[model samples]
Target: MKKGIRRFGGYKFCFVAAVLAGIAFVIPAAWAEDGVTDSEVVIGQCAALEGPAAGLGTGMNVGMKACLDEVNAKGGVNGRKIKFIASNDGYEPDKTVDCTLNMIENEKVFALAGYVGTPTAKAALPIVQEMKVPLVGLYTGAGLLRNPVSRYIINIRASYDDETEALVERIVSDLGIKDIAVFYQDDSFGLAGLSGTEKALKKRGLKLAGMGTFARNTEAVKGGLASIMAAKPGAVVMVGPYKPIAAFVKEAKAAGFNPVLATISFVGTENLIKESGDAANGIIISQVVPSPDDTSIPVVRDFQAALKKSFPNEAPSYGRLEGYVTARVLATALEKAGAALTREGLIDAIESMSNADIGGMSVSFSKDNHQGLNKVYMTQVGGGKAKPVAKVARP
Candidate 1:
């Protein structure tokens, strides 16, 4: 059954009906899980599809589709096709809660993947814990996500702590940069990077020369730019989406302030360049995933081929690579779960992976350690796109 869109609080949400629909069902030889019938296993996602962070959602969806298409064409994992349903949260915390509940209570998803932003994930965490739903490959490095130990969440990327630690060390050592300033989005996502940068700088017996903040979901960068430029630090670590980051860069360049600027992966790299135009030159960015253009790794080539096959017109990007990696990890776990394929079995299979190598990258997970990837890569804008520089030395 095709789902209809209904207006809610001046926003039209079209995923609600299809999320709860069960059609063309077949019975398994034995029982499995709530989402896993004989023919399909449903997965849910809550992403920012209609807001400042919309690009990230759309790009990830495309990559996920490519991976799924390949898997389903091969008869899927144990003959069960994968069904993905996504809802838009507009990058709002409150809406994240609503979408999460609808996915779990109404849609009965086996797991959730590619939930974007720290604030949105923060809002949805407690509910995930309460309901015991698996959360895989969320695109944030908030301290809360890595701390206090939630059994339901499996993190695929390096934490902001890891990224910031590596970045600060590189700036202090290789670039001989001091008097560093920080510009961040004013939310959990921003705070996570801020806290990481602070801790990393503290280890070197130094503190931030300056700090500035911008509101979530808005590209108001006048205040943040002015405050950071006032300090005149050798470099600044930006923590926000691409629009605000780009606005800050463009405005700061116009005002004749072009210091060494670096940003975390949450700041959509492609969008930043497009929005900032020529002003994006010489900017630094830390990435958790490898470049999609690097064909040396088999995974990169696979991702490029899948992207072209699934979305011939769309270009390969960091966002799509992240999504492709997440879907690949989930698919691997599902294969290990056997024909039974219970949610518990899936979790167990993932946890049991010991130093699993995925295309030149190492991933490991255990009952105690839920983090899969510990590596972070750095890139700098040389021409029109971000080019890989080197790997950040882990602290």
Candidate 2:
């Protein structure tokens, strides 16, 4: 009887030990990493997916998904498929905050990517900082995102200062136009562009010939147009979304007030053409990404192929091409991070890149610098399309 009791006690002890061992092993696996699993990595985006600026957000999302889908088809990055979650903020700052919070806190995204506008980015930046989430490839060139260089934020495009400086140089050198005015949305985005234009003009010992402002997300540009018209400036630098800018252009043209109209890359080229019709012709636009139709460049060719394979019916645009480049860069960083897949590891991998060539475009990042791709291409709208231009001439 004592022998039987000893055998039973030994069995119970072994069972308890086995259970404890199993729990110990499961704990580490359960808490391996946030937004990362054995099979997948999750990314998030908050942008104006619907509204006047919907074209920018939707185009970017489509491009990113296309790249990610292609990567997944080819066994993914280091054996993990990327899952992208996009939330719409309608280009509104308040909605951007909500979308960003929901993505970080609820969706548990590993990183944020392809965010659209300057005001929206400003709104969500505090949350990103507080949560210490890495935000990659914002579309805005606002200096606020690039100035202090937060460790958690990464920019894949040129700055507004860069674009503005290029515009000023071309306008002054090629067109010999010194009487320049600004028509901009009255928000952080507009102010950022305004500041950039101001700095660029000041470098040449010049100032704005005139300035006009309109409310954000609205087509109420008549008053601003009147203000700009009153100044009778030779060239006008416009900073706003497609809708208001289109309205301003149509109204100004109707009033027979035609001058050199130039805008930054943030203005969706295709959408602006669609909205402005013939009025868009001869308008100058600065582009951060090469023309999607320019398949000569290796990266542009790859983007075209990926876009065609993934989205057969969708046409490529600068916004979508930018998105594709952003995803490719992020994917390269993710692959460099290896299978460990931690946020910090990913950041380190990105910072380690030195003039890394992703297809054709050269992108570089470091501990001191987070902005990549300083080159800006200039395009002119003609025959309902924006094409690369060597110089800016009078309309």
Candidate 3:
């Protein structure tokens, strides 16, 4: 049966008797004159809510709530209520493709939002293009999302190349470290970060001191740790998820080799801090989202308040901020796309984005550019918390 929009739930009026005379069983609600009915405006997302990258997914879910709650409180966009449908793809490429298909075909979502993982998101790219659904706020540093197939994808975070350049520049310029080593997983993600580091180093007349590879499933990373330690460099950069991060930290500390450990946003920093405790202190990582630890900021304060109200026991993390940013950017685009919120209208709205700040950072998009954020900020882990080190800037 089609649910009708009533004032409260009393069924005070008998207007339905007049409307029910028509052939169609479901009559449009009176408030839905502009096409935004009381049913729902559906949106979908797929993330690694299970498996290794689950922390990231959980965080994004929290942020998604923040956005939706805020939107619903204020009459929603175009009088349509936002209904978000999210699923877990287990951080696997093949699983992501299937999950995305289900979201599109079964759920009939208006667009894709807060999709996480580079490899996982990449698996669904062809479907996004084929179905003409807008993929918004993809949480990864992979450049493939922006290059070649930039039209359908709206990237909100800085790319791996941007983070790599900042990390390498800091290692070479500020730290005065020449012998830099890199340890990464043997996959497309690691390869992409490696390529960015190499390209950035080329501008400074230097090369990688050592390179080590580990499989994504490698829980015992002693071999990779030993390989990276053998280089005896002043700093070592890593491009892998949280499991290896903890393993490498434990093994490297045990080996009495504590080189400056830096990583792209993908090291699952929140999980590392939770597992490693004090060991996570002093470790540096790049971030594309605002620091949740810094609660003094107004945006962070409001986010915390909303999060506490909705999910009091749940802890805020990197993925939460990422998810919030994704929704904020998409809603901003939709607002600019006008009352007719179609996929093409969204693309055009995003393409015309300019100087719009979300909380702390300014996000912009252009006709030929879809990279929403170009600056990357450095963060240091200390006292079991991730703190922003320097202001975001062009790398």
Among all candidates shown, the one with the greatest lDDT:
2
lDDT of 3 by residue, 1-395 (tens): 01221221244334543454563446444322222334456788898888776887777877887878887777777766778888998878777887877787678777888877777777888777756678888878898888864688888889999999999988777777778888888877888888888888888999888888887656667777778778787788888888777778777887788888888887777887887767777778898877876776656776777777778887777767677777878777777876656677779989988988767667888877888888787888877877787632211
- lDDT of candidate 1 at residue 31, scale 0 to 100: 48
| CA-lDDT, candidates in order | 0.84, 0.90, 0.76
Candidate 1 has a TM-score of: 0.90
Q: Please identify model 3 stretches exceeding 4 Å from their true place.
A: 1-39, 295-298, 391-395
TM-score of each: 0.90, 0.92, 0.86
lDDT string for model 2 (141-200, tens) is 999998898888999999999999999898999999999999999999999999999999
lDDT score for candidate 3 against the true structure: 0.76
Which has the higher TM-score value, candidate number 2 or candidate number 3? 2
Global lDDT of model 1: 0.84
| TM-score ranking, best first | 2, 1, 3
lDDT, candidate 1, 27-97, per-residue tens: 45334356887788889989988878898787777788888888888899888999989999888988888
